[model samples]
Target: MKTYDEKHIKNVVLVGSAKSGKTTLAETMLFEAGLINRRGTVEDKSTISDYHEIEHERGNSVYATSLHTEWRDYKINLIDTPGLDDFIGEVASSIRVCDTAVMLLNAQYGVEVGTELLWDYIDRYQKPTIIAVNQLDSDKANFSQTIEEAKKFFGPAVTVMQYPLNAGLNFNCIIDLLKMTMYKFPAEGGKPEKLPIPDSEKGTADQLHNELVEKAAENDERLMELYFEKGNLDEDELREGLKIGMMKHQVFPVFCLAAKKDMGSGRLMGFIDNVAPSSVDMPAELLENGKEAPCDPKGPTRLFIFKTLVEPHLGKLSFFKVISGEVSVGQEFTNEKTSTVERLNQLFIADGKNRNAVDKLKAGDIGCTLKLKNSYTNHTLNFKGASGSIAPIKFPHPKVRVAIIARNKQDDEKLSEVLSEIHMEDPTIEVEYNRELKQVILHGQGELHLSLTKWRLENIYKMQVEFIKARIPYRETIQKAANSSYRHKKQSGGAGQFGEVFMKIEPYFDGMAPLKEFPVRDTETHELAWGGKLVFNNCIVGGVIDARFIPSILKGVMEKMHEGPLTGSYVRDIRVSVYDGKMHPVDSNDISFKIAGMMAFKEAFHQAEPQLLEPVYDVETTVPDEMMGDVMTELQSRRSIITGMDNRSGFQVIKSRTPLAELDKYFSVLRNISQGRAKVSIEFAEYAPVPGELQRKLTEEHQKELATESH
Candidate 1:
């Protein structure tokens, strides 16, 4: 392949729902461009895009694959992304670098949930798109209905550029509305023969032709005037007007295709090469520091890594796109994120699993290099003195989380090491060890997202892990003020120990004052490390217990706070004051005072009316109207406090606050209730007291577990 400048480079990403013919469309496109001898099917798994073993096993794409095809002296970089919601990170990162998006719609099922979900990302990136209704030859194909649904969901900007001439079982031809011509493909379906529209289809084609011309003309004032005068747009004028409209998102031309038969693919590919915006036409790269980095070959060299792969034979492949200037083999650069220097020794352009060695990758071009140290996804590598780094892609936060335990206790250390490597491969999966909960939690976009993670952990790292419910971190606090006294007396040897301490425990809040009855003149109150306050009032004017042992008394109180008496949970929001005590001269050491303080605090905490505080999540669920009632009812049954409700994008959004304990496996239950037509987002809200009945059960469970362990 020959080199092409930024002007002739077109970066386009292929996206759609699962089983939507995206992989087949890519295979047909490769065959049409003469890049491959035979088209590969998802069944046999010989296609370039679905090259991974997991993908071949599942018969769908699991990761984004980058490939390029040269047509009409233009290099088109096509990124085929996975269709599963679990791999949305793959879709998001691919869309970040592409100049244009080509979204495919399965004609059998129009306006699917996946289409709506991916469309949100496309809109977020503001990428100009071209929609193709594929698999028109399927028995259940409905092109007109699909178009109507597209217009309903995507707006009127979606206008037809091509339509099936004879759809269904005999779908062999497509009418190109822009050129006003008919393309008839052979029975085997490779290259189509161009022909004039037949007499029977002329009326339908004329109406669509006028719609296409007017849609194109409306974007450009001069083109509109010319269209009104000449009654039609010339070929160059039509192309120019469509380009402007596409860049402004005012036009989203819809086409028809039979990807399996390779029908109508050539026309789609031709339009992409000629009409899609190039790298030079894309908007400037906005830096984190509010600076713009345009595609200039003469500027400083900079590149960003969007994907990382570790092939069995090849050590590591760092896939990157050049943002400014040019980068070549043996070029050393500093990573703006890590401040580490790395050399681009061997550069290669990727075509699925195959790689072609290239000496350099220019500005606005995508390529990969071998063996980069300290450079990871969303990181920018630039020349030594470069000031700013390009903004990174914003991936969605993890929605599903599980507490993972090592089935074999010996694999605990290895489990963390393996998860770290997997996180490098797919950053969307998060692994955290919560010390308070004493569980290693794994989080991802959905169950399948984290299931694949467990599969890889076991298959690749040979570790057995089990996922269970994550424990909620509940806290224990008091409501009232109370006082207690404890005395320690030990006589075993020559130096016997004896000490006594009297302390008061009270609920503490910001700006809370000392006890009104015993208001002291000098009370040195210190805020607790986690929460609450500790007021050390020296009310003993005669130095009754001695000032040296006061520190020891406070230490004992803190140790008890670590394990509250109610449920063994951490205690917070309380004030402890060691007001007075009696100490023997010889036995009043730190040890005697500490023991006395611990006993006194425990007694007071029991009388203070302690309560358990549970974490609450601010949840937002979007469900179709048909399923909204059931979803709301289910939430209400789970003790949900509905905060707000509204309609958005053809779905009802219900916002509520629900206890974290009540939300275990709630995602799966919600899917079952909505039949997978709903989505939920949750975040941590303030902690509230657990219900009285539930708190009693929790305390009993904790006590039983402790008793069982002791036995």
Candidate 2:
């Protein structure tokens, strides 16, 4: 395939909900462009985009695949992305690099939760977009109804550019409203036959044409005046106005297609070539030197790594978009983030499993470079002496966590390395060691996402891992004030250890209530007494306790602060006061004082009100109204408290607070309840005290486990 410069290149990402035929549409486009002689079907596992083993087994796209096709003298670099919410990271990365987004909607399903989510992301990035109503040949497809749904969810900017000639299985042709002509295709393709609109459909076609003209005119004041004065617009004027409006995101042209039948695929391609913005039409690259540099191939090199893939055999492949200047093989660029220079070797354009070598890559072109020393997704590459780095794309933090352990000891070391490489490829995925639980956790958007990563670990990296339930990070704290004393005495050999400590434990509730001595005034006014401070006073005026032992007692108290009496977990928000103590001159030592401090703290903590704190999460769920009741009931069962609910367009937005532990398996439950119509986002909210009985049980279990582990 011939390469195109920035002016002729169009980077578009195909995005939408699951099973929306986004991959099929990409396949059809490739076929129509003559990139592939015979079109590969999704079910047969022969399609170029869905090439992964898991994708073929599931018959859906599992990751984003970049494919380039030449059509109408333009190079369309299409990134076909997975629609499932689990793999949204791929969609996000694709959106970050693409100049435009083409959202594919299943004609039968119309707009869906994932479609809305992708729309929001596009809006957030302020990228121009086009909506393609696909699967028109499906039995339940309805073009008009789908258009209405699109307009309702995406606003009135969704103007129909083409109207289907027929619905369902008879859908073989479409009327181009802008051109005011109808094109029909034969059962087997050569080229679509252009014909005048049929008498019966001419009236509807004319109405659609008028709507398109009016929408286009509204984008420009002069055009609107001319349209109102002449009751029409010239074809050239209309096209120019619509193009400008689309670039500004004031208008979104909707086209219909049956990707499976390859109908309207050529027309869709033509529209993209004519309407989509080229690299120059899009925004200029913001260089690291705090300057808005034009997309000039002759300028200094500046590329952004938007995606990374780690293949066990092939090593790490870093996919980047050249924002400024040109990059060639054997040339080195500095990674501004890490201050490391990496050489570009074997520059290649990715098309699923195939990589076509290219001698040089220009600005606005997406290509891959292998075996970079310190390059990963979101890293900005530039020439030396660049003042600042380009801002990285922000992705949502992973809210869901799953504990994963190597299935066998043999895979442990390999699992660690594989997980690190995977995390590097997708920054949204996080792997961390939970010190308290003694487990390695893999966190992501949902269960399926983590599961897929595990599958890749085994199949792609040859590392076996087991997914286990994650443990909640619980904390312990005191509820009230209590005082206790402990004496440590031991006599064995010539020298013995002896220490005595009198300590007081109290709840430290800052900004909650007045201190015991302050009453309603500020604690500063009553310096002698305060609620939050841990006071250590030397009251051994008569030499009852040795002064040398005071520091040891405080050290012992500090060590006891880590594990509370209520649970074998870190304790917080408590004050410990060491008032007085006694010690023998020769026997007094740090070890004896430390033991006394631990005993006194345990007794005092029990005397005070002890409680366990569990992590809470703020959750937002978007679901259809019909499924609201079910979702609410499930949340209630999980001990969630509904904070608010609002109607957002046709969907219900539910905001609630749920314990993190309760939401561990929420992704699967939500899928089952909403039938995959719901999308949820969650973040850490705060920590709240757990109930008394549950806290007691958890504390006992934790203590027993710790004892067993120590033994």
Candidate 3:
């Protein structure tokens, strides 16, 4: 394999809504570049980009697949990403390391929720963008409408470079605004015949061409002067202006394509080869320590792993972008995250399942290495003496979670190891063993994401797993003050057990006044691990209770706090004062005082108007104006409190606070009601008191559970 210089390499990530034909476009690009003799389609399950069995089964891309085309004078590394929002992690990882993002707008839909969702990542990274209006040959294709929507959502930076003379059924010609010519493709659609603009379409093409020139000129002062001087930008000048505009995110040049028919793909590839910014042209990579690492082949070697894949027979393949210097097989680097030395035993430029072994990859190149013991996605590896690491990609937090258990109890340990491997591959899928809930929880982007993980576990890992509703981690707190006394006394043994404790319990807030009924001698406020604070007051005046015995009493109180009196939930934000207690010196042991204190705290808690608090989350749902009523109605049914409302890119954003209990499979519900047109993000807000009815029901259920356990 030939290695290209950083200046001659372009990393372009294809991203858009699902069914936008990104995978088909990838296949067409490879075929047009002569990297492949024949093109494949997603329908035929032969496209290089959708090589995974799961993706083939679903008829869509799942994982982002990398392929490269060594076009004339340049090597364009293409990262074909899944368009579904559930697989957005793949998109995010691809965009972070790419020089430009080619966003495909399905002509039929114009702009969709998936487009809007992926746009968030592109906007955040501020990467140069190209908007490709795909499926222009579909009967329902509407290029003009797609352009208008792109401008509306992506803003005025959208600049049209080409337009289909006939966009629907018989679409075969594209008017190139930059070249002031026409590209008429053969019905088979490979290389296009360049022709003069016909007089019939000359007027429209000239107008668009002038607009393109002006849009390009707006990016650079020199280009603006050149355009003003000549009333036009020459081809070279226009390319320079567009490249600058793209790099600065001031212009998102748009093109039209019918990827399925291989129409306009050669022109698209030509634009990428000639116009797209290379990694060397981009700004220096930002580092975690607020430093920059310029893409220099002579600089110290640094590799940032963006994706990890574990093949059934191939072991682990770590895909990375050379942030600096160059890497070759047998080169050694230390993983900044794991602090383990790893040798690049093998290197290959990936083309779907094909690994073309290469000896060296220079700066700005993307390639994969086999069996890097400690390296995984988001990890940075540095050569022996090189320090510092690349800034890690920030994956989105999970919006849905469920408890996962192996169908066979004996597979529990193996399931855990497999889950870790899955998390290593996709950081968006978080796994945790919630000790309180006694269940292994799997958190992911949505129902589809979790279901895919389950499918992989059962199919690839050969483990039967079941997903169940995760229990809400509720908390217990008091609403008022109350006092109670308990005596733990027993006379069955030679040494009797006798310890009495009297304590007052009250709701504790950050700045609440101290108790006046009993003077607090020493205050010890504990920050509970679950949430909130527990303040223990030493208030036994006149030595009514020994100072040493007070800790035992507090220990007892903590036990009840861990297992709340109402619902066996963790208790928080309360103050306990032991104002008075009696102890038989000989029989008053730590166990005796602990028991008395626990009993006293529990009794006082019942009288303190105890309340159960359920975890609440801040949920923001973005939906079209037409579907807001349905989404709002569904949210109301979930007992959601609307906190705020906003608008973004023609979508209405509804922000609400809802209890965790009401969020089970909430993503699925929202998808159904909005017909998959809505997007939601959830984050933990704060724990709030459950409604009276819910509290009553929960307490009853807890009592029944205790009754059953006693048997």
lDDT of 3 by residue, 150-177 (tens): 8999899999999999998898999899
> Backbone clashes in each candidate structure, one number apiece?
0, 1, 0
Which segments of model 3 are wrong by more than 4 Å? 492-494
Better of 1 and 3 by lDDT: 3
- Index of the highest-TM-score prediction: 3
TM-score for each of the candidates: 0.87, 0.91, 0.96
CA-lDDT, candidates in order: 0.84, 0.82, 0.91
Highest lDDT scorer: 3
Candidate 2 lDDT, tens digit per residue, 1-711?
465788888899999898889888888888888988988989899998998888888888888999988898988999999988888889988997898898888999888876766776798777888899998888999888888888888888898889888878877788999888888877654368899999999889889899899989988999999998999998888887788888888888988788888888788788778878877787776655657866777777888899988765788888888887888888878888888888887899888888999998888899987889788898888875344567677777786899998889887887787788788889878999877657898889888888788888878877767899988877777778898999999999999989888877777755544334311211111112211234333344555666666667766765666655666666666766666678887998889988998888889989898888888899999998899999999999998999999987678999999998799789899999998889998987887989778887887887898799899
Measured with C-alpha atoms, the lDDT of residue 428 in candidate 3 is 94
| 10 residues in a row with least lDDT, candidate 3 | 111-120
Q: Provide the lDDT at 524 for model 3.
A: 95
- Which residue runs does candidate 1 get wrong by more than 4 Å? 165-169, 197-211, 218-232, 384-387, 405-411, 479-483, 486-559, 574-601, 623-648, 651-656, 668-678, 708-711
Pairs of residues clashing in candidate 1: none
